[model samples]
Target: MQDSDSLRGFLFDNMPIRGQIVTLTSSYQEVLKRHEYPSNIACLLGEFLAAASLLGATLKQSARIILQARGSGALKTVMAECASDNRVRGIARGDFKVCATQTGFKDLFVDAVLAITIEPLQGQRYQGIVPLEGDNLSQCLMGYFAQSEQLPTSIKLAASTQESAGILVQQLPNHAPLEQSTTDWQTINLLIKTLRAKEQLHLTHNDQLYLLFKEHHVRLFDAKDMRFQCHCSRHRTARALISLGEPEIREIYLQQELIDMQCEFCGALYSFKKPFIDALLRDQNKALR
Candidate 1:
């Protein structure tokens, strides 16, 4: 279980390629426990969690990456976010009973578009959207890289109710000769394609890479721990409420004395009473003035 709830990076010493592997156990279960999801929806959420973790490792600065998809079918929307610090949270919204009846990606998500959003702690945020044209989440991600990033990338993702795991390999700007780099990339991709779901779920990070690239010299990096953490707080939630404007706040207050806000990612609740709301609005009015 060395790989459980951890992310590790690797480099191909002989080639200009790098990769990362992520496995989730306790964190995956933590997300599942917050809301009741169908088995299939839960599995898809796991893949998204693993994918976000793998993508977060690629960021050069402190940031958070979100992998989200929206559709008009039984599966309405699913989102997973992972920060540079490896804090992860995810949610799915749809009819679970209807979602359980479907199995294929397309069936579950008709007319779906996958969006990858990166929010840096300091810089502006960026997002890329692509049609969900592939058979699985892995293929959709590969298409996104090919279309948006223009990088040769290979991704494998697998998730069961018990565990979720993913691996991402990308060919960096060519350092080797064209022919050699092409051959190396193809060789590595072929080997990675041979990886089995069972191995991805059960093997240690070292063993998994060794099993795939024993013939090549691969350098594995130290493991980084990951955990389930919701970024929601009373302050953040209050800020969100303040965005509704004074009129909206007044209207809501007329219906109820306390404004209760509950986080969808984690079930933490934030309640704002009349006095607090009044002070908050006064501060906002002063700032505006």
Candidate 2:
């Protein structure tokens, strides 16, 4: 429902916690063009992609958040990354299908975990994996906040080839600075729990917040830019090929004529021929010496 391609943040002046929502359109479409993802998998990936965007906003430093789904079923995995500066990219693996009118947490994902990774611009990556507690991505996220963070959090996420959108609500501590209006966290949590997924997908950020917190003072920040970008190239792929070992490279070259490596992130193909592969291997060995 948003016309802009940016992640937005909002706060209840009298509430204990703040929330973020981000919708990606052009960014989501770019990822879809890189591969022919199954419709249901694409939707799953889109939801996680938007979640990563919101998660990235919660960091205090230059960081990247990756929302990943690993399952033992048809959809092997889906991952999306959003960086401190709002760069967005994602990919989905495996062919997945869904047939349900009103699905629950267990119906769609089956056996899966929602893993969140926080990688700072210059620090060790911190990751947290929570079971897919609900059929919907939002329920799984809510469970994470309630259990891991102990903060009451609610989320709604959606996406298609055309666009991706989401909304999040959180209950902050009473001691937080934003609680001047003195509304109890429990009161706000109840209000947030009433937000339906359909309403979130159809409403604008301001309108949605106004609907819930009309009686309280709220602060909304300007939207942060979001885009599609992949940090991979021929050189990186070539380095990966070099790491595969000279004998391995030679075996493929002597028989197959080309060593082909497909980048899952961008769907780019990196191919090495006999001479090029040999030269790369020699360079690697020389560097090792």
Candidate 3:
């Protein structure tokens, strides 16, 4: 791999808080493997990929987190999803060719939303969509933590063809995770706001926090590997095709000789002939017995 990657969590033993730093290298290139995304949108995917990884690590249960930006701009939407297994994937929609020429944060995002969705393997899923805040993905996520979780959280993320990195700093809730107050959270958030892109992406996990809080004590934890993997297959595609309803499948069959579905994450294609479709339906019927 040209770009080695890692995910490390740190604990501030005496501060009543903990956080994570996520880094990616070739894995980012893997995201751009099959598509030609404009530089800005490519960077957006990387930022969201790092954000999703950081958020997924906070979950105690087996969960996946999806970070998405959606709006009416030339670049209509982009999404990144991270699984419990550390498998990551992302894609952008429409014309993702916009460039940011302004200096201010709000000038960058214009109109959009930062949506976080948590899906547990064996439980009901939940989603929260908040209006876009700040100029970039990091600030938008930090804004989310402030408004929704009130955790005094801050995030800084960077993306390039070679790598993607993100740093997260959040104060522990005064009460349980569910009962923390929004007032004190805002006060402590000021400290987190001091992070810069260079420090977040350049420093080591240990050094990053040490540099940020030289006056405080912090505990470091084991790191995990993060990589790119596509979770799509012919079987999955067949299952999805079955859900399309007979009418829809017939419509596809009418215009196309074979149904060829491609996986956006990995660029793998799954094509099904009419016979294969019939066999799938038969197998599905047999399995339902």
What lDDT tens digits, residue by residue, belong to model 1 across residues 1-289?
8878999999998899999999999999999999999899999999999999999998889999999999999899999999989999999999989999999888998999999999999989999999988989999999999999667999999999999999999999965789999999999999989999999999999999989999999999999999999999898899899998889999999999999999999999999998998998899889889
TM-score of predicted model 1?
Answer: 0.96
State the RMSD for candidate 1.
1.3
Model 3 per-residue lDDT at 29? 85
- Report the lDDT tens digits of candidate 3 across residue range 96-142: 43533333435445587878899999999999899997767776787
Question: Candidate 2: misplaced stretches above 4 Å?
Answer: 97-108, 172-183, 243-246, 274-289
Model 3: residues >4 Å from true position, as ranges?
Answer: 1-3, 97-111, 174-188, 279-289
Q: Which stretches of candidate 1 lie over 4 Å from their true place?
A: none
Please give the lDDT score at residue 131 for candidate 1: 94
TM-score of each: 0.96, 0.84, 0.84
**Where is the poorest 10-residue window by lDDT in model 2?**
96-105
CA RMSD, predictions in order: 1.3, 3.3, 3.9
